[model samples]
Target: MAIPLSWWLTVAAALFAIGLYGVLSRRNAIGVLLGIELMLNAANINLVAFWRFITPQALTGQVFAIFVIGIAAAEAAAGLAIIISAYRRRRTVVVDELDTMRW
Candidate 1:
Protein backbone atom coordinates (compact mmCIF):
# COMPACT_ATOMS: atom_id res chain seq x y z
CA MET A 1 0.00 0.00 0.00
CA ALA A 2 1.41 3.39 -0.99
CA ILE A 3 1.04 6.50 1.09
CA PRO A 4 -1.66 8.94 0.04
CA LEU A 5 -0.95 12.33 -1.50
CA SER A 6 -2.70 14.03 1.35
CA TRP A 7 -0.21 12.58 3.81
CA TRP A 8 2.67 13.99 1.83
CA LEU A 9 0.94 17.34 1.55
CA THR A 10 0.29 17.43 5.28
CA VAL A 11 3.92 16.72 6.03
CA ALA A 12 5.05 19.40 3.62
CA ALA A 13 2.69 21.93 5.07
CA ALA A 14 3.88 21.21 8.60
CA LEU A 15 7.48 21.55 7.54
CA PHE A 16 6.75 24.82 5.77
CA ALA A 17 4.99 26.22 8.80
CA ILE A 18 7.87 25.29 11.07
CA GLY A 19 10.34 26.80 8.69
CA LEU A 20 8.34 30.00 8.44
CA TYR A 21 8.24 30.27 12.20
CA GLY A 22 11.97 29.69 12.43
CA VAL A 23 12.70 32.35 9.83
CA LEU A 24 10.50 34.88 11.57
CA SER A 25 11.58 34.16 15.13
CA ARG A 26 15.28 33.47 14.78
CA ARG A 27 17.74 36.31 14.91
CA ASN A 28 20.78 34.36 13.80
CA ALA A 29 21.80 34.43 10.14
CA ILE A 30 22.59 30.72 10.01
CA GLY A 31 19.27 29.88 11.61
CA VAL A 32 17.43 31.89 9.03
CA LEU A 33 19.32 30.13 6.24
CA LEU A 34 18.37 26.77 7.70
CA GLY A 35 14.75 27.81 7.82
CA ILE A 36 14.87 28.82 4.19
CA GLU A 37 16.36 25.47 3.30
CA LEU A 38 13.57 23.70 5.14
CA MET A 39 10.97 25.68 3.24
CA LEU A 40 12.63 24.79 -0.03
CA ASN A 41 12.61 21.11 0.86
CA ALA A 42 8.95 21.32 1.75
CA ALA A 43 8.22 22.78 -1.67
CA ASN A 44 10.18 19.97 -3.28
CA ILE A 45 8.16 17.41 -1.39
CA ASN A 46 4.90 18.97 -2.51
CA LEU A 47 6.09 19.08 -6.09
CA VAL A 48 7.09 15.45 -6.10
CA ALA A 49 3.89 14.35 -4.40
CA PHE A 50 1.75 16.22 -6.89
CA TRP A 51 3.74 14.91 -9.75
CA ARG A 52 3.43 11.33 -8.58
CA PHE A 53 -0.30 11.56 -7.96
CA ILE A 54 -1.46 13.90 -10.70
CA THR A 55 0.80 12.94 -13.59
CA PRO A 56 3.17 10.11 -13.00
CA GLN A 57 4.08 9.91 -16.67
CA ALA A 58 5.15 13.52 -16.94
CA LEU A 59 8.59 14.36 -15.59
CA THR A 60 7.90 18.07 -15.18
CA GLY A 61 7.50 18.01 -11.44
CA GLN A 62 10.67 15.97 -10.88
CA VAL A 63 12.57 18.32 -13.16
CA PHE A 64 11.24 21.32 -11.28
CA ALA A 65 12.21 19.76 -7.97
CA ILE A 66 15.72 19.16 -9.24
CA PHE A 67 15.95 22.78 -10.33
CA VAL A 68 14.74 23.91 -6.96
CA ILE A 69 17.35 21.75 -5.23
CA GLY A 70 20.07 23.24 -7.38
CA ILE A 71 18.92 26.75 -6.65
CA ALA A 72 18.68 26.02 -2.95
CA ALA A 73 22.23 24.68 -2.90
CA ALA A 74 23.52 27.78 -4.61
CA GLU A 75 21.55 30.01 -2.30
CA ALA A 76 22.87 28.21 0.78
CA ALA A 77 26.43 28.53 -0.46
CA ALA A 78 26.10 32.24 -1.16
CA GLY A 79 24.25 32.86 2.05
CA LEU A 80 26.89 31.05 4.08
CA ALA A 81 29.69 32.93 2.38
CA ILE A 82 28.05 36.24 3.16
CA ILE A 83 27.37 35.18 6.71
CA ILE A 84 30.95 34.08 7.22
CA SER A 85 32.28 37.35 5.84
CA ALA A 86 29.93 39.33 8.03
CA TYR A 87 30.95 37.31 11.06
CA ARG A 88 34.61 37.91 10.32
CA ARG A 89 33.99 41.63 10.06
CA ARG A 90 31.52 42.04 12.93
CA ARG A 91 32.20 38.94 15.04
CA THR A 92 28.48 38.22 15.28
CA VAL A 93 26.03 36.20 13.17
CA VAL A 94 22.96 37.96 14.50
CA VAL A 95 20.87 39.66 11.84
CA ASP A 96 20.04 42.77 13.81
CA GLU A 97 23.67 43.46 14.62
CA LEU A 98 24.83 43.53 10.98
CA ASP A 99 23.06 46.74 10.09
CA THR A 100 25.99 48.77 8.81
CA MET A 101 24.07 50.41 6.00
CA ARG A 102 22.27 52.82 8.28
CA TRP A 103 23.31 56.44 8.06
Candidate 2:
Protein backbone atom coordinates (compact mmCIF):
# COMPACT_ATOMS: atom_id res chain seq x y z
CA MET A 1 0.00 0.00 0.00
CA ALA A 2 1.15 3.49 -0.81
CA ILE A 3 0.17 6.83 0.67
CA PRO A 4 -0.13 10.05 -1.25
CA LEU A 5 2.34 12.78 -0.54
CA SER A 6 -0.34 15.45 -0.67
CA TRP A 7 -2.32 13.74 2.06
CA TRP A 8 0.70 13.42 4.29
CA LEU A 9 1.67 17.02 3.75
CA THR A 10 -1.88 18.11 4.46
CA VAL A 11 -1.95 16.31 7.75
CA ALA A 12 1.43 17.67 8.73
CA ALA A 13 0.41 21.18 7.80
CA ALA A 14 -2.76 20.89 9.83
CA LEU A 15 -0.81 19.72 12.83
CA PHE A 16 1.64 22.56 12.48
CA ALA A 17 -1.14 25.09 12.14
CA ILE A 18 -2.87 23.76 15.23
CA GLY A 19 0.38 23.97 17.13
CA LEU A 20 0.88 27.55 15.97
CA TYR A 21 -2.57 28.49 17.11
CA GLY A 22 -1.99 26.90 20.46
CA VAL A 23 1.21 28.78 20.91
CA LEU A 24 -0.38 32.05 19.90
CA SER A 25 -3.53 31.76 22.01
CA ARG A 26 -2.51 29.85 25.09
CA ARG A 27 -1.52 31.81 28.15
CA ASN A 28 -0.01 29.06 30.29
CA ALA A 29 3.69 28.17 30.15
CA ILE A 30 2.97 24.45 29.94
CA GLY A 31 0.47 25.00 27.19
CA VAL A 32 3.05 26.96 25.22
CA LEU A 33 5.58 24.20 25.71
CA LEU A 34 3.06 21.64 24.54
CA GLY A 35 2.44 23.72 21.43
CA ILE A 36 6.16 23.94 20.69
CA GLU A 37 6.45 20.18 21.07
CA LEU A 38 3.53 19.67 18.73
CA MET A 39 5.14 21.91 16.16
CA LEU A 40 8.38 19.91 16.36
CA ASN A 41 6.45 16.67 15.93
CA ALA A 42 4.67 18.07 12.92
CA ALA A 43 7.99 19.01 11.36
CA ASN A 44 9.27 15.50 12.00
CA ILE A 45 6.22 14.04 10.31
CA ASN A 46 6.83 16.15 7.23
CA LEU A 47 10.50 15.20 7.12
CA VAL A 48 9.69 11.49 7.32
CA ALA A 49 6.96 11.77 4.75
CA PHE A 50 9.21 13.58 2.33
CA TRP A 51 11.99 11.06 2.79
CA ARG A 52 9.64 8.13 2.30
CA PHE A 53 8.04 9.47 -0.84
CA ILE A 54 10.74 11.58 -2.41
CA THR A 55 14.06 10.06 -1.41
CA PRO A 56 13.30 6.38 -0.72
CA GLN A 57 16.98 5.54 -0.82
CA ALA A 58 18.29 5.98 2.71
CA LEU A 59 16.92 5.70 6.24
CA THR A 60 17.95 9.26 6.95
CA GLY A 61 14.44 10.23 7.86
CA GLN A 62 14.23 7.58 10.53
CA VAL A 63 17.56 8.67 11.93
CA PHE A 64 16.46 12.30 11.86
CA ALA A 65 13.23 11.42 13.59
CA ILE A 66 15.11 9.59 16.31
CA PHE A 67 17.30 12.61 16.87
CA VAL A 68 14.26 14.84 16.86
CA ILE A 69 12.59 12.70 19.48
CA GLY A 70 15.66 12.89 21.66
CA ILE A 71 15.86 16.64 21.26
CA ALA A 72 12.17 16.99 21.97
CA ALA A 73 12.57 15.00 25.16
CA ALA A 74 15.38 17.25 26.26
CA GLU A 75 13.33 20.30 25.34
CA ALA A 76 10.37 19.03 27.32
CA ALA A 77 12.53 18.38 30.35
CA ALA A 78 14.10 21.84 30.20
CA GLY A 79 10.79 23.54 29.51
CA LEU A 80 9.21 21.76 32.45
CA ALA A 81 12.04 22.78 34.72
CA ILE A 82 11.76 26.40 33.61
CA ILE A 83 8.01 26.37 34.03
CA ILE A 84 8.28 24.94 37.49
CA SER A 85 10.88 27.44 38.47
CA ALA A 86 8.81 30.28 37.07
CA TYR A 87 5.77 29.07 38.95
CA ARG A 88 7.74 28.98 42.14
CA ARG A 89 8.95 32.50 41.69
CA ARG A 90 5.77 34.11 40.39
CA ARG A 91 3.15 31.86 42.00
CA THR A 92 1.47 31.74 38.61
CA VAL A 93 1.84 29.78 35.41
CA VAL A 94 0.36 32.41 33.16
CA VAL A 95 2.64 33.57 30.40
CA ASP A 96 1.80 37.21 30.79
CA GLU A 97 2.56 37.12 34.49
CA LEU A 98 6.02 35.74 33.84
CA ASP A 99 7.26 39.10 32.62
CA THR A 100 8.97 39.65 35.94
CA MET A 101 11.20 36.65 36.54
CA ARG A 102 13.19 36.56 39.74
CA TRP A 103 15.54 33.70 40.49
**Cα-based lDDT for every prediction:** 0.96, 0.90
Question: How many clashes show up per model?
Answer: 0, 0
Off by over 4 Å in 1: none
Q: TM-score for all predictions?
A: 0.94, 0.92
Model 1 steric clash pairs = none
Clashes of 2: 0
For this target, which candidate reaches the highest TM-score against the unseen true structure?
A: 1
**Mind giving the per-residue lDDT tens digits that candidate 2 earns over 1-103?**
3879999999999999999999999999899988998899999999899888988898998899999999999999998998998788879999887775556
Report per-prediction Cα RMSD to one decimal. Answer: 1.2, 2.3
Model 1 scores worst on lDDT over the 10 consecutive residues at 94-103
lDDT of 1 at 49: 94
- Per-residue lDDT of 8-53 in model 1, one digit per residue for the tens? 9999999999999999999999999999999999999999999999
C-alpha RMSD in Å of predicted model 1 compared with the true structure: 1.2
Error of 1 at 3 (Å): 2.2
